[model samples]
Target: MFLAWQEIKKNKLRFTLITGILMLVSYLVFFLSGLATGLASLNREAVDKWQASAIILTDESDKSLYQSSMSIEQLNDIKAKKTAVIGQLNAIASNDDDKQNISLFGINKEEFLMPNVTQGRAFEKANEVIADESLKDKGFKLGDTLSLSSSDQQLTIVGFTDHARFNAAPVLYANLATFHQVKFGEAADQKKDQINGIVVRDDSISKLTQNDELDSIEIESFIQSLPGYTEQKLTLNFMIYFLFGISSIIVAIFLYVLTVQKISMFGVMKAQGISSTYLSWSVVAQTFILAFIGTTLGFAFTLVSGAFLPAAVPVSFDLTLMMFYGLILMVVATAGAVFSVLTIVRIDPLKAIGG
Candidate 1:
């Protein structure tokens, strides 16, 4: 350990250069990780907040919650410990010709989870809407009337909530009846009681044995069926994995070349009776120190960048992921050191000493 430290101190420029490269690589990986996680959250924040153990959608819909429709009778047939009806629609909201695409969700006022009215009461009457804080930022205020296209009903914002977004759009909560009316227009009267699906709080229901043609699936299973969630995750994971592999290879090659250059020194030490085990430990210690310094700097950079970034840019840090990735970086760095140290054991002291 002492020898390793002395060597690193003697070659400050070389060591610093390697550390800088490592830091840059780690920074990219960490930053991309946060971006991926943040985007995923933005895409599915509303559904995640439901905290429901399962969601039931029409089997015939093939795992599409947005398209699946469950009649009121089917919802009643679902005997779960706890359940709530959910409806989803996408439409444009216009005020004075300023329009924004919005994701509209319908919930039974009695069973809605999350967004528990930070300002005003939940939707209690038809045509009343509770929206996210973004609405205020967009020049909307409580009691302000907004019109939905293709509908005669003029919706009124009744409340504002935080942390409520869907598909990257601010969520607007309304009563199932109103949502049905807005979505189906006149047809809503004949199917006023229907819902898109049932959100289950527990998994006590027996494997579905329904004779109806509709499909049923757990919430997670349903999310996996979304158009691009799985593919996006896979793509991000591949990039992260590739970065790790590159880091490992770069470290291994650098350390191996450095070790080869120090072969004579190692030979002299071994000839003086220094055990290969102690030398290997020294190499590993140096690797640990380097990785720790590099990754720490990288983490700091990520936090600083995140601080200065605008709110519109999505970047989030999950402590568990940070720790896990840190550990992975350490392991790969240490493995590289080990790969280099193996060459030390193969050194022949006699030839090194010119015997």
Candidate 2:
């Protein structure tokens, strides 16, 4: 370890250049990882928050939540331990003549995973709505009237919530009856209580007794079945894997060539009775030092970048992924050091000493 430290200190310029390269590579990997996670969160945040174990949709709708529709009877038949109706629709929400495309979620006021009334009361009437704090930036406030397109029935912003977004749009929550009326117009009868699908708490329903008209799937499975979800995940994973491979190869090649250039010095040390084990430790210690510095810098860069990103950007930093990447970087770096040790073992002490 002492010898390795001395050598690295003596060749500061060369080691610095190599460390810089590794730092940049690691930074690129972490930055791309953040972007991938952010994009995925934006695409699936609302669905994940539901925390439902299963979902029931129409079998005739080709397995798409957007296209599936269920009647009151179809929803009730699938009820198990706990069930709630969810009505989804895409429409425009306008305040003060400024309009934006938004996803409308019709939910029962009594059931939801993370529903907290941050401000004002829950929807008490048919044309009331609650929205996220982000909507404030678009000119909406409590008691403000927002109109849904082509509908004479205007919605009042009764409350605000947090962390509620759907498919990159701010979610507007409304009572099931109002949701149906806004989406289906006068065709939706408030007295008859109809909804799009039923969210179930479990999936242990007997297959033989199940209704053939409705498709029941686990919530995780249902999210995976969404269009572009699997493909986007695959693309992000491919990039992350490629980055890991590139990091390993760069470290290995740099250390291997550095070891080769110092073969004569290692041979002379061996002639002086230094053990092969000691030389191997020297190489490993140097590799670990380089990896530690590079990875730390990369992590710091990610935090700084995240700070500057807009709030609407959905980057989420999970501790699990951070630890996983750190372990991976260390393992690959140690493997690179092993490659360098192999070259040291091949050095002939007698020739090195000119004996």
Model 1 CA lDDT for position 20: 85
Which digits, one per residue and each the tens of the lDDT, describe model 1 over residues 1-355?
Answer: 7877887899999888778878888888888889889877766777777877777887677787778887867766666777788888777787773676677888887784635788887777999999887667676778877787657767888998877777677788998888888888889899887788888887554454264665557677766767677788788878988888888888888899898888888899999999898898888888877887888888889888888987778788776797688778877877888777888888888877676
**Native-structure RMSD, model 2:** 2.5
| TM values, all candidates | 0.91, 0.90
Error of 2 at 156 (Å): 2.2
lDDT at 169 for candidate 2? 77
- Misplaced by over 4 Å in model 2 are 149-153, 190-193, 203-209, 353-355
Clash pairs detected, candidate 2: none
lDDT of 2 by residue, 1-355 (tens): 7887898899999888877877787777777677777767766677777777787888886667778877766764665877777888877888885787777888888876426778987788788888877788777789988887756668888998876776667888888888878876877775346666777776474441178888887777777777777788789778878878787888899999988887788889999899888999999998888887888887888788888988767677665686578668767866777788888887889876666
- lDDT, candidate 1, residue 257? 89
Clashes of each: 4, 0
lDDT on C-alpha atoms for all candidate structures: 0.79, 0.77
